[model samples]
Target: MLLASIIMHAAQPIRKERSAASIYHLLQGKRSAQTLQDAHMYGLTHLFGIYPKLSRQLFDQVAASVMNEAERYENQDIPYFEGMTYQTQTESFLYRLLLLIQLLSNHVREEKRYIPVTDNPAVKHWIKQWYRQEQHRLDDWRNAIYKELYDLLGKLPPLQAALFVDRLTGYQHIGLTPGQLAGKYNIHETDVLLYQTSTVHHLLHHAENKAAIFPYLAALTNQPVHKTRTITSTAQKTRTMLERGLTLDQIAAVRGLTENTIKDHIVEMAWLDGEELSRRFLSDTDASIILECAAGAGTKKLKQIHALLDGKYNYFQIRLALALRRGHGVEA
Candidate 1:
């Protein structure tokens, strides 16, 4: 139900402009310009990249059921997700927490031999470093971690908290796999993943925002929350050329890409850096006209906006204008 609600929420805004596959790509973290533009254009940025490992088969099944019962999944308040900001951090944070819990649990029981929960060399290496620094104070570290988790998990829904706790491989207890969790809760396997994701995101948000209150948990975060979204590497190159006063056509020629591809890069940069770069492509007056036309038409379709304007502005101008409408100003 949670995954369905998320899909339905994302689908409602872009139903007229894009297909269901677009949303799948966004959730899978495609990192393509089209998916990135779709996220910002449809106000689905918060849901972007939330499920990178999502299967196409599962998504199709859920999306099909959701479209038939679309009205049932509206108005869901998904406050726990900040996928665009935390996409790189969520899984790493969870892995660290799980490993730490297992290590602490086994250490307290004086258990000398046990298999690690994860075979990730990086995670194991990081834990080894962390353990060495705090080995002499394992009891204090254990108590602190318990308190931090207790406080953080207390803020989540009961079911979500259980989903998180049940995944921890501690002491003699082995963590339940997602399939096992699905069967135990009588829900779809996807729901198990979503519930756990929501829980972790919630923990991350609190740890970052309420750091003073969650010192130990906050310290576990490997990266800071992003203040602005990032554009693709290819887009960054285009930005470098644009910054050097190169026209789009010239940049396209120089970079061996079509003019259309360069424009896509500009649009992506507009999504991330806002009006600072997009304004160079279109005048403020024209942008204002496009914004007004879009608002009047109640649509973000560039074709509709262009027709409404009697084709006075080109498609690129219309697109640039719309991208700038919700843009952030030059940051200090």
Candidate 2:
């Protein structure tokens, strides 16, 4: 799964990748509506990630209301998003759900209040012309995607191809629900869903492997490609300190932080860099020892690992090894 996840690499859109503070300012410092939308959005891109099935008792009428409002305003300008154009029918639906959830959450959190976004005018005169232009280009985009899919299916074994073909129908390539496809194939529902997801992961990467699909993928996830997960401010500083050849204690003192804190940061840096977690911070021998200990423990719990190693490796060294083994919190 991890290998498949990183086969394609692309920079996420500036809009999707903007910091939380930037999002607040973008919406003109509103009641965290954009931030809230971002929270739900993490699920959109990881279509194959593990999430608990929503229980019937937890279903909200707000979702139904949002979907209703979305259908009502389809192809019309939405006041809630303040006329953001990247928003298409699907995006508006999700955004509407976020908006209603925000209202309901705020009402529950503090006092009665509603935050509404002002609507801007649609690009009226040029709207149809622009849409027609997009409609024309849409064919080129579809052709590119289909070409890649065809090539991928061509390379796949027959069983996999057959499993995948069942998902598409007619000239339009409409998608079938997993339950429908599962029944057709006489396979477990889970197996059908998993197989479809595996093929999709392959094709998505094939389509996106060459370049970052900005608004195209952004329109789907509403979240960035998440550059920060692999590198951070403290990690950056740690690298610079190591470059200066300053020892951990010396760097910690200079930076006005505890040596332990500095060590933790160094380990985090290692985690970010994977097997390349620089020899300067963690020697090859020390890292190997930590890795061996962790594998034996079969868990990443700091104390359990610390105990298993029996003082051979410190907490920080153990952590760095764990990070490297776990692919260092990176998708690519």
Candidate 3:
């Protein structure tokens, strides 16, 4: 029985080709003689099933107007044939309008519309009130679609459904190409595209169920805590060496790496050597004094000693003269 119903539904083709002249010709004779009930039934059976319910509402509303105009054409109160022609024209306009609406809905679903929070009180208040009213309906729709899709494809290997939602919504939010998102997540681009299509249907049905989707999305995209900690430690070390008057080359040599590599590290650490030192070590008077002391000691024996005291003494406290004149103390 289900199979038969599916076949019957599939057999009903959605009429896509449309033109004003074509619509006028189709409705010319029917308007003057057709009953509203007959028109409604014909339109519902022919068009309504192919589209979503919201679209059907628009179609029915326009159809109702056509029915009223047709009644006027039947009365012959306005020039009989001209009234019939005008009714045909109106129906044609309505048909095109409905087609345009469907195109827009598809575009919106594909593009993933995001409404921003507005500062205007009226807009904010209205959205809040509207959400309160529709929240339950949205939850119900989300649950239904999630269950339906799970039932259909759940037998496949357990791919993270939350991750799929994240990729879909991220694409919508960030306008990333499927290929880009796939690369970021280490998945196939085709999989991302497929998930995007499935998500569109789910979003349309459960427009209000965005809450659960975002939490999962955050988890999928969130930076790993350990990675963040490692980066932070590297940054702290870079800044300390930089403040201690270590040139990029010197730091690189000390770390036994290339100068460019050390510069890259500093860049990632958000440090700007000699140009804009980070605020992290900006207030450390000890660091500032040490850097000054070592500034001119780059080639002398004192330079080697200063390097030894790298993190220990401030520049002013290093006593350069005392060290240099150690064996010639009374020769002043």
Candidate 4:
């Protein structure tokens, strides 16, 4: 129900304007220019890439069931989901925390051997390095971690906190799997996953913002913990070319892509880099006209805006302008 609710909430803003698959792609964190653009345009950036492994069959089923009752799933205050900003580091951060907890649990019992919670080599390597560094001060490390987690989890809702705590593999207590958690809580496995994700995201937010309070916890993540938004790699390449003063046609030829593809990259960059690049494809006056048309027509639909302008601006131009408008947070 929580996963469905989140999907339904994301669908509402772009209902009927975009296909169901678009929402699926958005949740899956497709790196396409279109998906990224849709996220910014529809104000779904926070939810973007929240569930990268969502199965298509499940999404279609949930999407079909909730299409008519989207309003019923409206969440006035959805839990913290800065997927766009935090997706890259969330899993690694969680892995480090879990592995650290498991290590601490066993170390306290003077146990040298225990199956690890995560098989990821990178996580294991990081944990090993950290343990070696703090070996002599293991007790202090453990106490600090406990204090940090106690204060941090206290800030979360009870259920979310439980989900986080239940996933930890302590000395004698094996952590619960998502399936086990689902059965225990009587919610769908997917909801359990999402709840766990929400809990981790909340903790990550606190760690990044309140570094003083969560020093050890914050130090667990090896990945950059800043909240910087990013663009797709392909679009990033296009941005590099643009910086070199290459025209759209020249870029297409050099990159072996169509001019239209190049234009798409440009628009994607506009969404991230703002009017600085969008104005290259669309002029200020033309963009103003497009924004006015969008405001007057009460839509960001490119065709409608193009038609409103009597086909004076091509779809690409109108799209570029709308990207700027959305980037600038222009009213309407």
RMSD of each: 3.3, 17.1, 32.4, 1.8
List lDDT for all candidates, in order.
0.83, 0.44, 0.35, 0.83
lDDT-better candidate, 3 vs 4: 4
lDDT per residue for candidate 1 within 48-123, as digits (tens), equals: 8888999999899999998788778877755478788778788888888899889999999999689999999988
TM-scores of the candidates are 0.93, 0.41, 0.20, 0.94
**Ordered list by lDDT, greatest first:** 1, 4, 2, 3
Stretches of model 3 off by over 4 angstroms after superposition: 1-246, 268-332
Error of 2 at 201 (Å): 1.2
Q: Residue by residue across 1-332, what tens digits does model 4's lDDT show?
A: 87778887887778668898999998888989999999888888888888988999999898877766766787645688888877888788899999898988899999878899999998999888887788998898899999988987888888888887898997878999999988887889998878777877888778778888788887875446444556878888988998999988899999999999988888887787778888777779888888888877777778777787888989898888878755333354
User: Whole-model lDDT for model 1 versus the true structure?
Assistant: 0.83
Model 1: runs farther than 4 Å from truth?
75-79, 225-228, 327-332
Clashing pairs in 1: none
Top TM-score model: 4
Q: Which tens-of-lDDT digit does each residue in 61-157 have in candidate 3?
A: 4444544554333323110111211221222222222222222333435643543322445444543464466445544534444454454334323
Off by over 4 Å in 2: 1-133, 137-145, 169-174, 210-269, 275-285, 288-312, 325-332
Worst 10 residues of 1 by lDDT: 323-332
Ten residues in sequence with the least summed lDDT for candidate 4 = 221-230
